[model samples]
Target: MELNLKRQIGIFCVLLILPALCSAAFTKSRATFYSTSDGLGTPTGRCGYGDYGRTVHGGSVAGVSNLWRDGVGCGLCYQVRCTNPSLCNSNGAYLVVTDYGAGDRTDFIMSPAAFSSLGVNSTANDELRKLGTVDIEYQRISCSYPGQNIVIKIKESSTNPGYLSIVLFNVGGTCDVIAIQLSQSGSNTWVSLQRVDGAVFQISNPPSGTLRFRFQVNCGSGLEWRLPKNDIPANWRAGATYDTGIQF
Candidate 1:
């Protein structure tokens, strides 16, 4: 009976540890860098983040091809490390996916800053850049931005009271925002917003009133719905940002 009890306890411990181990597992891939004079991401990248993409994560950003998932992969974070012991650091770079790109048989086309972060020092970094491409391993990681909540940005293309286009910003956590629905205040009917571009969602003929939003997110473990504490004003304007007052 004691032996059986010990076995059960051991199994329970393994179950607890397994998830952490799995989360840390890195998959092998190839990575290359894009040219930006300042080693930063492009404001005009495919994600539609604009100037925010240029400085997000302090410019440690990447463009992923296969992982794009029809724009769902935008804003996802990953920890990437190069395998070359002589030229690369083990800790690697932590980057946000802000664009879509594909390289010669590569999964990640990182920003110059992100690619250089894999090196141990300036000398190594220079050599790595000269190589132009390298073997890398990467794993998805949760994103966190200190002192920032989820922000909804009204795209400049939106037309008042008829069309609404918005983007999600500072979307932390390891979840993918799969869907968003907007409803008029105190109304049971919810209108689903469609993904029009990377990180951009839109709806036409939106209900005319104060609007509240709910997001459906999947964090690999499971799918969950998140509701924001704030509501969009009836007279929402283009080029404005609304703080959700919450994080994923």
Candidate 2:
């Protein structure tokens, strides 16, 4: 009877500890900041994204090395907080993956403006200069938090009605896009779209007129949105790409 009672006590202890372990989310990483000194002649990133400093949360840009998977890392968001409790904010600072780094480092490279906003010490002479690098904890968050979402741009070939090209932007979240489908307006039929590359997809002999898209995320869910004929941009021209900021 005593042995059974001791076993029950052990099981109870395990249950008590499991929840704490499961709730721990942040991952440890090193972070540093960069600016014009970094010699980024062109502010635009490999992913074709730029103007990050002008985001709602000023200076929200960050760079990662090859681990960024080329342009695939673009538009992903993260919450970063200094490991030093004294310098950290209760809510941490939000960062967007806007560019890639040249060197191979596990560190998160933030824009100088982003680093300054992290609650780090900023003296009158130098803002965030004293705190050159810091140990931080970070976790990936959905881009939707910033009112950003996946965008699709269509490029039709005037000579070949059977060929269609599409570019995807602002791809981020818990899941990557696994598949895409399109349905002609007023039709119940759905047709598959084929991936041409990491950021492009294609469909041959697509139906004309207004259409809707269904994007299947790897997380076992899908997002659907539509574009009306009237909503098509006035500058849209065959064989010329036009960005349609359709979210989700």
Candidate 3:
């Protein structure tokens, strides 16, 4: 009886420890900063997102290189804090991966604005010149924290009924959309959507009916949105398309 009680205590202790382990998913790395014209054009990045101003979570933006998994890293958010305690903020800044760079051996490349926003310096250029680079820690965070989520829209191609154009918008949190799938009405099976570019997915010969979309985010989470059957245009004709606005 004593042995069983001890085993139960051990199991309870292990369960108590698990949440801490799950929360500490951070990595240590070096970081640098860049500005808009630092000889790098307004990069559309691998994730195919346009340049927004710095100041994510009220902090500046970060440009990561080696971490860029094509465009998969585009819309994900990260919490970055300087390793140098004196240079770091009590609350590290939040940043989104909007661009990529030719990463140095370091782990992150911050936009000039992002670096300055971290209280590293008054200006990104000044921080770049003063620090050149710095040590930092980063970890992935959920997209829902920002109260935004991925939005998918579908449009019929003007030229072909077999080709459907899908676009993503208001991509908050997950960083980038890696995989997309569609389900036709009356079918439990899901069909994969092909990437035509950063912003577009193509479904060839899509069925005529209501469809559902599933987006696999870069952070290993999945989001789903469905369009009701009646929402689909009747007799989907060639060159005809419909747009389903933002969905969860």
Candidate No. with top lDDT: 1
Return the clash pairs for model 2, or none. none
Screening candidate 3 with a backbone cut-off below 3 angstroms (N, C-alpha, C), the clashing residue pairs are 34-112, 46-71, 47-71, 60-114, 75-175, 76-175, 143-173, 156-241
The residue-by-residue lDDT of candidate 1 on 31-97, one tens digit each, is: 9999998989999877789988888977888999988999998987777899999999978988888
Candidates ranked by lDDT: 1, 2, 3
Q: In lDDT terms, how accurate is model 1? A: 0.84
Q: Which candidate is the best by TM-score?
A: 1
| lDDT (10s digit) by residue, model 2, range 70-157 | 4456556667777766666545566666667643344578776556656745542153346677777776555542343455556443
Candidate 1, clashing residue pairs?
none
Off by over 4 Å in 2: 1-22, 36-43, 50-57, 102-104, 124-131, 145-150, 154-173, 178-212, 220-235, 238-248
TM-score against native, each model:
0.90, 0.58, 0.63
Q: After superposition, how far is residue 44 of candidate 2 from its true place, in Å?
A: 1.3
Better of 1 and 3 by lDDT: 1
Better of 2 and 3 by lDDT: 2
Q: Please rank every candidate by TM-score, starting with the best.
A: 1, 3, 2
